[model samples]
Target: MKSNVYMFLLGTMCLLLLSCGEEKLPKPRAMLRLNYPAPVYEDLDMDCSYTVKKNKMVQIKNAKYTRPCWYNMYYPDLKATVYLSHYEIKNNLDSLLRDAQNLTMEHHIKADGIKNKEHINEEEKVYGTLYIVSGNAASPYQFYVTDSIKHFVSGSVYFDARPNYDSILPAANYLQNDLMHFMETIQWKN
Candidate 1:
């Protein structure tokens, strides 16, 4: 029995020596590597007052409401959607702009910071602002494009999962570029 106990201790000592050879390391924190396909954009085929280019990977569907011209541009693989709403400007441009701005401001409570980038294409008559919200906000990006006379269109992006800025950063970034492309390609039918 003493010899068996000694053998067991010897085996444990061998394992401990072998395991201690390499100084242990808490693995350096690693972030997820997310890869998305290169975006191929084409004019979004829709019967609306204006047309814009959209990423081919996006699936456009009507919003879940009765409002006309409201759409949800869904990215199935990313599990994210860009909600879009169109309104006709009829002496309510100020209110429309305010509403769009207010929507973005709503996320301020949870956002680390908000950056507004103005978009202006005088030739296309598209003038707007893109609001990029950082941190764990429900919506990471929002924008409103308007001719400032006849039409106003606003959009916001939301992911299906809970907001975790670090986890969703890559996908949010890809969608940001896509949204910018959408804004750049707007052409009013009227």
Candidate 2:
């Protein structure tokens, strides 16, 4: 009888511990969205090209710059640069991305009751800090910006925290909608 009582108490404690642990979920680091105008590449007649897709929400452009990697994405709420970088320009891009991340962190804290946290994920081709924001009234969002030896790129998406899957979806969808509109209006100058 004593053993049985002890086992029951232990099981209850384990369950309580599991329930009390902080729930971890994927979140966005920023709330900005991208939009681009339709592409008219053939007219350019250069090695570089641009295209519009996803109902004009994604503007894709390619150029051959010093680093052999040049592309740009402009969303209604956000603008992204993925292009060749001269050795000197690399540091500037890095600084810009870092500044943007810091700005996002400050904004997240001020976003109602949202809590902001950062997750750093790096890869050879792409790397940047992701800001994840969460709150009862707010949807979790991720801000990801990355680049490569010759290119720089960044983006964000509002996503719900795992398991809950309740609040973030709307925000994510909203961001997507805005991005599409943004891409449609983008124009690249000669």
State which candidate has the highest lDDT: 1
| Global local distance difference test of model 2 | 0.41
- The count of backbone overlaps in candidate 1 is 0
Candidate 2 segments exceeding 4 Å error:
1-88, 112-124, 135-142, 156-190
Q: Each prediction's Cα lDDT score?
A: 0.94, 0.41
Cα lDDT tens digits for candidate 1, 29-119: 8877999999999888577899889999999888998698899999998999999999999999999999999989999999999999899
TM-score of each: 0.87, 0.32
Displacement of the residue 90 alpha carbon in candidate 1, Å? 0.4
Give candidate 2's TM-score. Answer: 0.32
What TM-score quantifies how close candidate 1 is to the native fold? 0.87
